[model samples]
Structures are given as structure tokens and as C-alpha cells.
Target: MFRRRASVVLLALLLAGPVIASPPAIDPAARNPPPTIALSHFDRFELQPVTLAPGLETHKGNVVARQYLDVDVGERVPRLIEPRNATPVQGEPRTLLIQPEVADIRFITGGKRVLFGGFAGSSWALVKLRLVDKATGEVVAEPQFLQHANSIAAGYSLGAADKLMLARLADMVASYLKTNFDAPVGSAVAAAAPPMD
Candidate 1:
């Protein structure tokens, strides 16, 4: 009776060994490619329809304006995709969020022009931006405060001009990522494979 029981137990252990001894499963995030940036709008600032013109030459100095710039992913995504060599698998890439804060915009218009309306000068815009991982809530890129300046024309809307300059900045960022960010966005160190006994 004892010998029969031992044999049965031995058979059961042999059958269960394969199931019990498998290594732990890998995290789902590891298999995927880098996170793609999600479509995002400006949070702290608002884009108004009103256009900005060369107002009266202020006594203080350059005219200062405050507004948020909007990023249209539908329009800009193709531009971002252009520089990247790898075609990431669809539906597998994680999502990242782009946030921008407009600190201040300074317009430098001095003297007076004849044909173009006035002797308009360059406009310098200060902006703060960040990129964050949606799933992990990690800040992928360091907080950046950028000052982008462009020559102001006669009929250019403030919002439209701001959008164009910001879009160029975004393109530069995408190019940087294409060249520098080669590895997975935020992959953890892989665990060693379970040793075969």
C-alpha cells in the first residue's frame, strides 16, 4: 500500500513540475515600441481669434502679449513621422502628452515704415513645455522654457503667428527624438531568464 501511494505522488510531481517551474511573465510594456505623442491642446493658455496688430508705440518699450499656442496633431503628425525611419506597430505604441505654457510674448516694433504699415520689428515669445508619459505619469522630457522670435508682418494674427513658431519648435523636437531617442521610451531593466536546472 505504501509503495503504491509513493508512486502516485511521484507521478503527480512529475506532471506538475513543468507548470510550476516556468519563469515569471514579462511586463506588457516591454514588448511595445516607444510611446507616440497624443493629440494635445494648450492647457494654461487660450488661443483667441482676434488678430494682433502693431499698436501705438508704448512708452515703456515693446508691446507684450500673453496667449497659449495650439498644436494640431492631425496637421503636425505627418511632419513628425517624416523624420523617423522606423514604422512602429499600430495600436502597440504607448501614448505621451505634450503640454505647453505661454509665459509671455514681447513684440518689438519701433519707428515707422511706409509701405508695410509701420517699421515692425521682431516678436519674442517665451514658452514653457513638457512631455509626459500617460501610463506611467513620468516626465519624459525635461521642462523647457523656449524663447522663439519671428518678424511681425502687417496683417499676421497673433494667434496664427504664435502657432506657426511653436510648430517649428515642435518639429525640431521631433527631429531631435528621431536622431537621439533610439531606444524604447521608458523600458525597465529586463530580468535574467530563469536558469535551467
Candidate 2:
């Protein structure tokens, strides 16, 4: 009986050896987090010409609205991004491209706006934008923005509210870029520090 018990214990120990020697399973992502991108990673930003959706070109006033958005956003984004040139330099690694497209648009003319006001209907514009890395051809981010012009008071003065909506859309895009463009603390410090030489 004593010999049989000793053999059973030895067999159990041998069976458990592999389990004890092997490392526990751990997620690789937990050990090393994925990389995150910040606006500081880019040295230049390019805003592409704003475009209208395929079917929207036939709609009345949409072409003009597209032009307005193109100018408005084009002006505002550069002020916030600090780079106006769309041309990529040779061997440039840190350039970002911003593409804005008008997905949908509803335009209420001034005459209709004055006569019907909010009863006629509200004017609205939907814009879809993407931020892409010029070097790697990777899309960094894609976001959509919507702006509306609704005026309950019907009058000549408020007829141009639709135009104001375009301006508001531009503001929204600028604000979004500004909020996300924060440089990492380390990078900011390094940039501020003078040359060691």
C-alpha cells in the first residue's frame, strides 16, 4: 500500500509540471497599448475643395451652397490648422489631408423664407469630412457635421438665415479640429525647449 501511494503522488506531480512551467495567457494589447495620434503628429494640413453629393447637383441653389461651404470652411480650417498649402513636399511624412463633402443640403430661397418663414421649412446642410495621412495613406478620422437655419419670425431681415447656416457649419468644423489638435505634453515641451547645441 505505501509503494502504490508514492507512485500515485509522483504521477500527479509529473502531470502538473507543464502547467506550472508555462506562462499564463495574457492579451498582447494589455501589455503594449495601441498607438494614438494627435494633431501635433502632423506638420502640415491640406483642405481639399468641398464637393457636393452626386444627386445634389441637380437641386436648385445646391451648387451655390456648395460654393459657400467651400469658401467658408476653406477660410476657417486654415486659420486653425495653420497650413494652407495642399501641395505635398517630396519626402514629407507628416502631412494631413482634410476632405469635406456635402452629403445633403436643403435650401430655402429668400422669398420663400420671408413669406413662409419656419412654416415653409428649415434649411439645413450636412457635411462629411475625413482626415487622412498623406504619407501612409491612412485615414486618421472621419466625422460628420450638420447645421440648420430655422427662423420662426418671418421677415425680410431673416430671409438670409440659410447663408448664416453655412457660416455656422464652417465654425463647427474649425472648432472640432481645434479641440482635437492638442499636442502631447512631451512633444510640446520638446518643441518649446531650445536647441541643445
Candidate 3:
């Protein structure tokens, strides 16, 4: 009977061990602090037209890519980052100038994507985003974002895949700004900045 009791207790202890050792659940907000405090200081935002890097001037899709980036990001910022608590700016409204420059792009044609899928290589774009304070002429943040459309399923949508990737990149930029700008000042650490891509 003692041996049986000992075995049962040991089994109970084994089952409870993991439960006792488990860490307490942490709040999601606490884990991810704001990425950039400088963004929070602005009352308004002005997005410059997206430009191509010097070498990309002759790229086939340069015009389309620039237009997409400009439109998508411009539309998304107002939807995502605006309507937040506004920090009062003295005299002129504190505006953040957002400049996105495409560093590189590899666009796979819809026909090729449909026929060859991943073998045609993924459609990707690398954009360097610079944020500047209009009032102080201070450069706030410069982050690089690389976005890709790589799903075999994306081939079904053909040309829409590249558009979707561009849209997602815009969403990411807007979301990042919203997350960082909405947080309380001093709450975010630079080391905890969200992944660029």
C-alpha cells in the first residue's frame, strides 16, 4: 500500500512539475514596445512621391512600382495612423516628411509567374524609407523594408501578386507607424524596433 501511494504521488508530482515551472503569461503590449518615439511627436504627415534609386531609373517597372508605392502608402497612412490622439504643435503643425526610395526590384512577369511559378523567381522590392521632422529639419528614422511575393498560389492571381505585395508593404509601413506613434513617450526602446522587412 505504501509503495502504491508513493508511485501515485510521484506520478502527480511529475504531472504538476511542468505547471509549476511554467512562466506567467506576459501582456502582448509589454513584449512589443513602440518602435520610434520621434513619430509620436508629429501632428501631421506628408508623404513624398516614391522615387527609384539611381540605377533603377532605367528599370522596366520603375514607373509602376513608384506609383504603387506612392499611392498605397499615401492611402494607408491616413487610414492607419491618423485619427489618433494629436500632440499639440505650436504655430505650424509638426509634420513628418516621409520619403520612400526604391533601392532594388525584381519583377516577375505574370505570364512567367503562371508558367514557371517559383522557378521564375520571386517578385521582390527593397525600399529605403526616410522620415524627417519638417519643423526642425531633423531626420527621425530611416528604415529599409524588403517585401516579396513568393507563394505558388500567388501565380493564380498573375499580375495581382505584385500589386498585393506592394499593398502589403504599404500596410506594414502604416502599421509600424501606428504601433510606434500611439505608444506613450519613453515606452519604446530603439533596440525593440520592429523588423523592417
Candidate 4:
């Protein structure tokens, strides 16, 4: 009786070993390409292209400063068909919360322009921006940052200028991030592989 019980237990163990040792099962829902990252609207607001009087001009001023996104992925990362631009490795997806933003705007009046000798004031707004991880600047997979617009100097137009300027600044920053750095938005984190032993 003892020998029979041992044989049955040994058979069960052998059957279970391979199943547990195999790679984690990929989710059926993830066979399709992942959705584009669903970027959110700005959570807060503030003036950009700001400067101090004469101390710094538009070209030398900081264009923007604001905060957005503090994300935490609560579930398993379904297997993802990484974007064409994404780099692949056998590792887990990181806990990421991208603060996608445009920054560093300098708004100042040019020395002086001719407003019938009264001088047409020219407002010069130069922008520089980036995508910060808010979590760590040292991480390699961190989003790539680029600066698109520069010295959009316009004191000539008198209507909706601020909004338009802001819009341009925002768009350039977004476009920059999209073109460089990080994986495609909404890509999934991978699971840890089972031990080879």
C-alpha cells in the first residue's frame, strides 16, 4: 500500500513540474496591438513665457512650469506588441507616470520697435521644454525631451495672443515627446519569467 501511494505522488509531482516551470501565460486579450497612450489634459494651470523686468529677456527666460500625471498601474501588464519605435528586452514594464509638458518660455518686449516713434512693442517668447519622470531623472528608459519652438516674437497681434502662444508651446512639447524617447503610450508591463532551473 505504501509503495502504491509513493508512486502516485511521484507521478503527480512530475506532471506539475513542467507546467510551473513554463513561461507565464500570455493574456488572450493582449494579442492585439495596444491602444495609443491616452494622454490627459493639463491638471493645473499657470502663466508661461514669464520673466523678470530687464533681468532676463524672452530668449533667456524659462518658458513653462507645471505638473501633471502621477500614475500607478494596479494590474498585471498584458503582453504587448511593442510599437515599431519601442526597444525590446526581457524585463518588466516600469511603474511610469509621465509629466508630459512644455516648459521655459521667455516673454519680454524687444528693445524698441517703431510704433510711429511711440514704438511698437515686440513681445518675444522663446520656449524650451522637456518630459520629466518626476520619479527619477537617472532612469535610462525615461522619455526623451526635445525643444521645437523658439523665439516666437509677436507683439504685433492684439487678440487671443496668450492662448495661441500657450497652445503653440503645448503642441511643440507634445510633438517632441511623441517623436523621441520612451515606448509607445499605453504599452504593457511584462511578467517575471519562471526560474530556469
lDDT score, candidate 4 = 0.28
Candidate 3 Cα deviation (angstroms), residue 56? 0.7
Residue-level lDDT for 173 in candidate 3: 63
> What are the lDDT scores of the predictions, listed in order?
0.36, 0.62, 0.61, 0.28
lDDT of 3 by residue, 1-197 (tens): 99986775565434322222111233324422333554767778777778888966665555667787789878777664456425455786778887878767765555555554444445677666777888888777765565667645456676678777777767666655765575633322112334233
lDDT of 1 by residue, 43-159 (tens): 211112212233322322222232222333224334544333244445545555545444344433222212222223344443334456656777655332233344444214433
| Candidate 3 RMSD to the real structure | 17.3
Candidate 4 lDDT over 1-197, as tens digits, reads 99986775565434322222222244523321222332222221111222222323233222222211001000111112123215443554333233332322222222221111112222223233322233454222322121122222333432223334444434433343333333444221221122111
Displacement of residue 34 (Cα, Å) in model 4 is 23
Per-residue lDDT of model 2, residues 1-197, tens digit only: 99986775565434322222112233322211111466667878888999998987876567878988889887788776665344455675588888888877776666556544554455667776777898888977665666556645323445577887777777766655665677321111001112111
lDDT of 1 at 96: 53
Clashing pairs in 1: 113-119
lDDT of 1 at 168: 49
Off by over 4 Å in 3: 1-36, 81-90, 111-119, 184-197
